[model samples]
Target: MDPTNGDEKKKRFQEAFERGRDGHVGSYNVWLENHGFDPSRVDRDKVTEFFRENPTKSVNQDDVTDIAEYAGFVTTRQDLHHIPVIGPSGIGKTQLLHTVIGLLSEVDDDIDTKLLEANRLGKKTEDGFLLDEYSRQIAELTTPIVCIDDCGLDKRIRTSLRELRDAVDAGLFVTTWTPERWGVNQDQVRDVFSPAKEVHLRSFTQSETKGTLRVIYDYISQDNFALPSKTEERIHELSDGIPRLIHLLALESLREAYHKELVPGHISATDAAADRLNLSNASARVQDLSEARLTVLKQILQLPDERGVQPGTLVDELHRDKSTISYHLRELNEIGFVERDRKGRRAFYRVTETIEPLVQRRISQEAEYNA
Candidate 1:
């Protein structure tokens, strides 16, 4: 039985207290061990501190410190409020929000929650239908918290953000957005989430990136396959602090090594270079794109490493609509010139390293001609 509910929790705590007070150290130690505590660890206040500090049984201290802190505040705060975790794509924004919700559930089993997806909110018609279904979903929810994962991604959701402000005022809405999109659409953010708390997550640091690489290394090395000396450094440089790219490149490298039938011992730098070369060749396919697609790639190339533009930004930059921008981005993705990452609803499209130099050379030539 779950001891958190009904009389079971009270009985357990009371027994622990009684055992501690009666000088029954042996019994108390057993109780502590049973509860996943160590009696050897000394504390002045005993089990009370343990119960207080560990309100949520699971706490992940590393790899997501910023995420954990924000989640902690949202779950423990007395007043229900809106929280929008803003960051770049592939940084685990959605996963962090869900983790918080799971931890909160441990304390309040009755905490009501629901997840609302923007794109699937309703179907479109020629005359443009109203978001009646969306209104009804928020209105009828018995849950105290309603999570809107991808806030600015869909046109319908972006347009309806103003309407959801009331839900935020009521402290029931949680949303996410990519920093680039959020910056481009500041007006929507200001109007819809005036009082919302925003948490911005940056890219991973070198140590963290190395740690991730170690995990990959350990996995491939289990088969006695050795990696190059500077393999981790090489991958970290190529990935540019983006976690998804790190995993993607690492997997590709492993696959290439296996395909070459290289002797099991040390994976060569040549094998690693082969993986990068393949990426470059795949990106070279962008030359087959039309002028229209090339225009989109040009703008994407100007974006910083591990940074991308949202559909709205692309629309504004290219003077196109959402559908057009999305279409071109998809094409760019298919050709490996641009890679897509999601923060919430916003999909950020950044040019891959394979095509970066080509785009930059074009830009330089254009600059010289204009000058």
Candidate 2:
């Protein structure tokens, strides 16, 4: 094929890709509405009401409100502004961003909101063109809020965020992210975008947890199950003030109570036990423990002379499948629970000191049980 022909084909492919992405956003909006979430636009009053109703769970409500106000103010004064919402995982960062976009839509119906997952966008073959495409989309919108959820997860897209910063500085962009692992200092963060406010959303407070319980109770009220105050307190304690965890615990508790026909009144001891069992099951599923990784760590622990297992020996002992072991090791390393030491060409991994005791306890428990 001729070079010009190839170039034309590539351009067409890029257009198709962007069109598909826009369609996805539209479909997601429809889905949200179908699921009873108001996706049309978030109005200030509606957002305020939501915050008021869901009071205690406002991890960073004040900061979020301030950012939204600033974004609204900037657009009123000028043409555009960029606001980045930053926080750790499960800190309600994504929900807050969506709420802001909803608010923006209320202020201006012409305002268009596009939700993009950075990891998904990063997988595109024509990712290099995304920033330009995003800028064009923003330019065409009467009001635009481009929400890039999980922005810092993809290094390529994050580097490209500088281009977005340029657009924002030029009055054409807005974005958000949960920046738990960005590892950037304040100066670096500030340099990325003008009028960029980094709002740190911490975990829920104890009060917030109790409020979250109230919300959960309201949600499950249709089932005619009313949890006792003591049960609620126990659920809150187990949830550690994490909204998602609280929801999970509450749902599990309700399910258990219903299973035992203990709904609409004081929960029985059996119902509480069932709830505890459900919680344990849910936690185990989410923990993603790697047996092979655990085994390797166990062997290292068992060896009296060696402080750590030889990389090759460890691989041989685990012995299931090379790819599976490699994948588990990569995951463990990424999560900071494990680390590798390189001595020239050879690499050896050891359980991080913090995790060593936990691994030892698990192994010892298994050994005792087996014996």
Candidate 3:
């Protein structure tokens, strides 16, 4: 959530309440759809009453205060250069960036800051030649405080952001997503956005602030439930303060609490939320593995036991060539999907815990399709 003053925070929350009252297709709506729950089935009146009573917290003072102080206010413009907030996927980099935007807006009310969301950066647009027209428009901006979220989404998007990349006053407050576990080339991204104040989001101890907790509960309370402090702490532990995971797991936990349940961790509610989606998606992207790798993984996943299965066995059972199976097997192992154990002469491969849920989901989808 973006931060504001006390009154503004309340106003902002109220606005969200009104906006989501009609069941706007935001995260909550998406979450319901993803979990195969009917959004239309939920009691809107009950949810609305719960939100009005609870009054979800919207102010995150720490986010702005820490970032602004780090940016060095009242000091020289040099002290307040463009800051890049880098972190793993789902670690709330974009949320922090939005908070930074809110904080920076206080400096000048009349002037508007620019924001380029890399995810939404499509090539064509309704406004004519997309890059040419956009580049022209941004180049003319008086206040070039361009805030770009995840410029790494596409290297080509950086080509359109020359003004920010090359300027000081009119520069980028960029949030670069750098999850190395997902096989992202960190150095390549860093070099592209070089000569900026790089703040790698390594420490995630307090990512789930009180404001975040209240914000999440606003959605949960829609189910007519209260978030216990014990359950909250358990969620933080499981999510490791990642916002997406926190939101999903908290809602999943809230669902559990309805049936007199304890806190649901990643493993417990992984089927509920695709927490490892990034890991699986990244493996596919980085390797350009196509469906062949997934085919091999599905086969490996079907195999029984932690004792593991041999490549020769997979070759015989899958009716695929040994070399084809071996190629994907090696790549899958590199992506942490499968673990290989060599018992002196022969090697045995078994599916790792990280990708078990994804494989299971795929298997289920296949079963449903076949039926």
Candidate 4:
């Protein structure tokens, strides 16, 4: 071959580098946009101002560290696939995953990524087309990193989730679900996502809750606003270490203040608590609660908090088949109307504290109407 012209050769190399780098960054930006981050909407000035005015408070270090570790593996295109991040609902599973994916996209534009929510998976009647579409889309992407949030929430999608095995083998999967869906043991968890690494997310500590509230207040407030100590403490108490509840409480409290036309000041903890209870009642009402299930819920609520009702007691009281009682209890637990606890080897189920007040209120109203 003839010797290359120096200027032309340098120009060709530069062009190739630019194309590669551009392709990488372009892919990442697309991922971020698809996941709802659309960087163009980001207000860099506001972010910079917030950082300057309020020093960053450390919270969710474990969550950040774990997600970053897995994200690093995914970005590097490693074989460490099937990451199941387990936590209760509203414990920041989706938020943590989004942040990790956002950071990964920023750093590696070439990586393929997709997010699927379990509840969004259509009903069994509609799953055929959905799965076909999922297969088609996944086929087009190369080594797609798929994060399926709330994996165990719906029964309709369990079969579809099983179909993800192919993707798990060929690419990577990061899923989040509650521990109640499956036990914490590796074998038990493997039923949901086999041969997987588990990242157990802890609920927010009281300090983390305060830090998070402050962070939220800073982000939404236009001025130097301070959350009252009592308001913060009440939020911490009623929120029960769940970040989603914390967010809901904060927003509802603000709305309460707004409705009262009060100057932007302290968010009333009482108002937040009432809104949360109302929300719980509304949610409980909307769910398809069969008479059997409702009766089961009522009984669970009557049981003392420390001593949750057992399946045998439910069977005795309802005169229902053991399997039927178990099914109803499982449904209630899944909807969060009930919580399951373990003492020794036996599992006990009880109505969740959040729903207790609503249940009691309904009972009182019914009694009054009867009288």
Candidate with the greatest lDDT versus the true structure: 4
Which candidate gets the maximum TM-score versus the true structure?
A: 4
What local lDDT does model 3 show for residue 204?
38
Error of 2 at 240 (Å): 2.0
Ranking by TM-score: 4, 2, 1, 3
lDDT of 2 by residue, 1-371 (tens): 66579888998779878955543245544443443334332122343355434444444367667766766665566655556665434446666766666666666776566766665544444545565676556556544566777655545554556765445433434444433223332245456555455555555677667666665454434333345777666665555444545554554443344446554323463246434533333333334566766665555444322234455565676665667666766776775556777777766677664344344434434544775
Candidate 3: where are CA atoms >4 Å away? Answer: 1-63, 66-80, 119-122, 125-129, 163-169, 181-193, 202-211, 218-225, 257-371
Q: Residue 75 of candidate 4: its Cα lDDT?
A: 49
lDDT of each: 0.55, 0.53, 0.53, 0.61
Q: Output the lDDT of residue 124, model 2.
A: 46
What TM-score would each prediction reach against the true structure?
A: 0.52, 0.53, 0.51, 0.56
**Candidate 4 deviant stretches above 4 angstroms:** 1-61, 74-80, 122-127, 156-158, 184-192, 258-371
Candidate 1 per-residue lDDT over residues 291-322, each given as its tens digit: 78877876664343345777788788789988
- For model 1, the superposed segments whose C-alpha errors exceed 4 Å read 1-80, 122-135, 140-143, 167-169, 214-229, 263-371
**lDDT of candidate 3 over 1-371, digit per residue (tens):** 45757888999889898876654546655555454444554443443333334322323344445556644442334332445665554455666665565556666554446667664554577775455555565667654455667655544544544434554444334454443211233444445555355555532354444346555454543443344555556555555555545555544443432233323233344333333333324323433546677667666644433467899988998898999889878987877778899999999997664344334334444444775
Clashes of each: 3, 3, 1, 1
Our tally of clashes for model 2 stands at: 3
